[model samples]
Target: MEATGRLPAVRGIDAAAPFRWLGWAWRDLWTTPGPLLLYGLLISATSLALSWAIYRTNAAFWVLALTFGFVFVAPMLAMGPYEAGRRLDRGELPRVLDLLLVRKALRQDVAYLGLALLVIYFFWGRIAQIVYGLSTWQIYRTIPEFLTFALTTAEGQRMLLVGSGIGGIIAYGTFVLVAVSAPMLLDPRASVFAAVATSVRAVSRNPGPMLLWALVILALVMLSAATAFVALIVVFPWLGLASWRAYRELVAEAPEPAAARPLNPVATR
Candidate 1:
């Protein structure tokens, strides 16, 4: 069950395709505005609650790390949107309860993928803590103190430089692994190995578009976090829907009507 029989062919795309994906996401968002917005709110609330807990405990360092590691859990968080997108793609009305429950993702491989992401998250946290510990013996529990030290001290600058470099590498690897895999798993035939392999191929074949997509996602998600997750109510759903669009185009080779296809459609199932 490690592989989903065989890998699906990846379609190449132009770098500007991510923008169109966002447009499609916007269009899809309105199809079931109430359920989708409510879904986004639910996730936003969960994220806010987690962030509040960290802030409450005065874990300033973790708050910063969590922001950087937010994408780690994103694929898992995106299940609902992916479900909605897939339903919409099939010319079927996306069921409210189905989108809400995301029952399709309650499979063994999904659990395995979630565990992998969880491990990556904790590993990144530990590495970030080590970097901070090496930079300064004293821990800054408060946000103001941490921000001041991180912005002013030479050691803090060095820590930021090194940590960012390491984090970027890890993030890119995670992106490749989860990009198509997450949504691909919704199919009963998908396995962790096949999904990951297909995702890697999708990135490898369309490096430019994939990187552009990754950056767009990063910028938007960070912007949402910058607002203390208030924007996440909309941003997360937008990105999730877009991610699902990306997955369908890159992983599944389903034929689409001319009106539905974006740019040059490449269906190679």
Candidate 2:
């Protein structure tokens, strides 16, 4: 915000901040239910379709990839919900069109962020395949068989341990980049670099609370996946809104544009 050279400074939140975000997100969701819930359903459907595609392949590795991959790709998918959160903040109800075809999300900086995450996603998938291949000569095709191997056998257990360790490092690094960047893109003032810079600062500044936040998101996503993503219709939106709150609270807002910005229906509020 200052001469485009210095980005906004992040404020450190207490460990309880993540928990409080849930309450705010829940309120925002119902306050603008029609659009946000519909948006969540859309994401849930996409998740189910993606999971089903991998299930059809009978490749347990991709299944595992897709499960953890949710954490990697979720922030990109949550852009619409971020807009919804912004709208709610301004006392405006988001419309279905706004949620579906988000104008702000279509810009170049977001595209860069999306591309970076996509690359990270594929890299994670490749690493997963490598781990699975190294774990055993025989590939486990069926989910049940894979489950037995993963849960009961020593080789399978070791594979999980090693893979999770690697994946956790990658996931946490991805989180540091995306913790606020994705939502910050909603503002015209934020370029991807500045957004990511601010995101990294916030998490590094408050690791304990941010780690708790990350774990909370993983737990919720796992629960939703357990239901074949039925719970995601609610949980996804809740998290998305919470993420917006995370951005708003973590970093101070940029100064308003000098000229009158384009009139947005939500901005009018």
TM-score of each candidate? 0.91, 0.92
Q: In candidate 1, list every pair of residues with a backbone clash.
A: none
Report, for every candidate in turn, its global Cα lDDT versus the true structure: 0.83, 0.84
Quality of model 1 by C-alpha lDDT: 0.83
Q: Distance (Å) between predicted and true CA of 254, model 2?
A: 5.2
After TM-score superposition, what is the CA distance of residue 212 in candidate 1 from its true location, in Å? Answer: 1.0
Residues 1-269, candidate 1: write the lDDT tens digits. Answer: 24435667788888878997898888888877777888889877887888889988989899889988999998898898888787776665567688778887999989999999999999999999999999999879898999899999999899999999999899999999998999888877778888888899999999998999988989988898888888888888888888888887776543342334432222222
What digit string (tens of lDDT, one per residue) describes model 2 on residues 117-141? 9999999988988998889898788
| Global fold similarity of model 2 (TM-score) | 0.92
Model 2 residue 65 distance off true place after TM-score fit, in angstroms: 1.8
For model 1 the TM-score comes to 0.91
State which candidate has the highest TM-score: 2
The superposed Cα distance between candidate 2 and the true structure at residue 172, in angstroms, equals 0.6
- Model 1 bad stretches (over 4 Å): 1-4, 252-269
